[model samples]
Target: MSHHDEEIDAAGRADEFLQVFKKGAEFTQDLLKENERLRFRVVQLEETLKEKGHDTVDESPDAIELKKKIEVLEQEKEEILGQIKVVEEENQNFANRYIEIEEENNMLANLYIASYQLHSTLDFKEVLQIILEIVINLIGAEEFGVLLLDEKTNRLEPVASEGLVTSELPSVAVGEGIIGEAVHSGENYFIDSMEGYERDFEKPIVCIPLKIKEHVIGVIAIYKLFTQKDEFTNVDYELFTLLAGHAATAVFSSRMYSDSERKLSTIQGFIDLLTK
Candidate 1:
């Protein structure tokens, strides 16, 4: 089955689980109320027997029948309590599962929105800003840089950065360091252990290579993550994979559009001069 279909099915199951949990909770409440009534009735019967005197009550058939009825009521109360306990446990499990599924669905919705925004713009700067926003807000990166490959220099040059000095960010040769290696091999690089990770100018925590098919175009080097973000989740990895493809296409398309506009302006200027 398709990934989207699986997500939809999971959402449906979450809704069903929630309905069952609600029903179980209502049933538990009814059981508790019935148990309270049974206890009250048992108390009334015992008080009557006490007032009648123990010896007289033991000899009476009516008192003996009352005692048997009290015993049966006590047994029924115990059974109800047991049923309530089991239902409570089942409700708790269902609630937890529903929460997990809800989180997954929310993440999927965010990814869809991000993907849409990435392709909605053709302006170069706007495209870059959207990518940066995805990395910061979605991926939870606090310090990172976007570097595009400079064909003439055969190096990756920093185009934009956050929480870092852009001028201090050095250009990397195509196959030299960690960032460069990702571009050269067209593969992502990330540290498995993020505990106590400190920012390093020479090494980044994560390096994602932006590519168009097999050709690598740029690199996103994240030095550190936000303080609250202790470790990466499955959704974070999915976002990174989405960025690698969609972000690259957006940037490449914008650059081509800008170049074409410049060429068109130059041609128009020459045609006006010839007419004059």
Candidate 2:
């Protein structure tokens, strides 16, 4: 309203602009560090490929185009002005990503805690059920299952499952279905859409094989309502893979302990008879 008031408002706006610019600068610094790491990784990969007698497309037309795009991005990053509000917004974007990741990390940690409690094995079935429940909670999948292979017959039988009918799955031969193939090959599999596996499912699915000592003992399958190639990110893959590894180890250890206790009890019976 007055000259003094107008001057004060302008100064406040200036302060806000400076804050945003600082945040933008911080974001730029982080991006540059990440780019450097990526470039070094690319160089190492290229050298490894060349050593393995593979031809590199680094000098190809597509690569040149990619380089031009990177240059454009760099130019844009440099041209961004020192506006504090804009930098603050950029910082907010970064903060949002960090928060999302933190939430995911907390969830995964909870899953691990629940899984670790299964190590006791006083009631192994209950522990497995809890783990299955957590899987659904974390992944938001429609249905899921844990399938263990019958060693003698190589048949995949559902040891634990959630949201699927009891009679739906069991006794699948290795490499027969998507889940079977993942188990047989000891690798994770994804069916972008389950059109071909038309028995019942029609959704996007991910199957992780639980293998110990190079033998796939079980599988963990996730099913979603819709199908999309990019539904799950690389971070999801990493987390799921780590969980699968823990599941494999837990199953193997439980089996080993149970078997050993059985054998020891049998030997104790013989000792008692001879002593008497």
What RMSD does each model have against the real structure? Answer: 35.5, 34.0
lDDT by residue (1-276, candidate 1, tens digit) is 999999999999999999999999999999999999999999999998787787787879998999999999999999999999999999999999999999999998999989899999899999999999999999999999999999999999998888888788889999988998999999989887877777776689999999889888898999988889988889998888888999999999999999999999999999999999
The TM-scores, one per candidate, come to 0.67, 0.56
Query: What is the TM-score of candidate 1?
Result: 0.67
Clashing pairs in 2: 17-84, 20-84, 20-87, 20-88, 21-84
C-alpha lDDT values of all predictions: 0.91, 0.72
User: What is the C-alpha local distance difference test score of candidate 1?
Assistant: 0.91
* Top-TM-score candidate index: 1
